[model samples]
Target: MAKLVIYLNCEDARSQAAFYTEALGGEILNMVTYEAGPWSDMPEKDKNKIMHMTFTAGGVLFYACDSIGEPIQRGNGAFFYLSFETEEEAYAAFDRLAVGGEVIESLKVQFWGDLFGQLKDQYGVIWQIAVENTSPSM
Candidate 1:
């Protein structure tokens, strides 16, 4: 089976990747700047920009890169859903990701008996965090 990975295009991939690493308690596995890659002939301004980056957090892996000579159009069609085994983990991650961003929904017990919340990160990415209730009254 083929593996699925999330790839993001942003204005500042390096800063965005760093923010995610800190917020999600993950590490940047690999990163390459345009100047360091085959496209080393890129303009000076873009040379320092990230050409590619790989990071993992809470078992989730992601790829990101800076847009090359193009405008980024952010939409609300997709979001990253994260399900945790514990409320502590879910809450901590939610809080960290909410910094400098908007919280669509604060973490709380939903009708489904799970602790859940939604937010847009500082980098304009949406995320949904949840913790399933081990013992649901239903």
Candidate 2:
């Protein structure tokens, strides 16, 4: 089977990874600095930047890295969709990610009978969180 992993490019990958771990309840599995990688010849100012990082939360896995010398353009075409088993989990994640960010949809029950919400995080990453209906419909 093929596995798909989301990759993100940001100005400060270290800080981004930390923020994601805190908001999404995940641990950074591995992080490599530019200086520690093959790019040791990079400028001193960029040497300490994160070259790559691996993060996983609630079975979701993704990678992130510093944009280095390039510009990062935030896009609105895509967003992360997180499904939680409980309302508390969904609300907690929604609240955490909403800090310093804009809420596109508040967490509440939808017509489909599930708690859902959407937001753009402080780092400009959009997310949609939801809790599936646990009981059968009439």
What's the C-alpha lDDT at position 37 in model 1?
Answer: 77
Off by over 4 Å in 2: 134-138
- Model 1's C-alpha root-mean-square deviation from the true structure amounts to 1.8
| Clash pairs, model 2 backbone | none
TM-score to true structure, per model: 0.90, 0.90
Which candidate achieves the best lDDT against the true structure? 1
TM-score of 2: 0.90
Can you give the lDDT of residue 126 in candidate 2? Answer: 94
The deviation in Å at residue 64 for candidate 1 is 0.9
lDDT of each: 0.90, 0.88
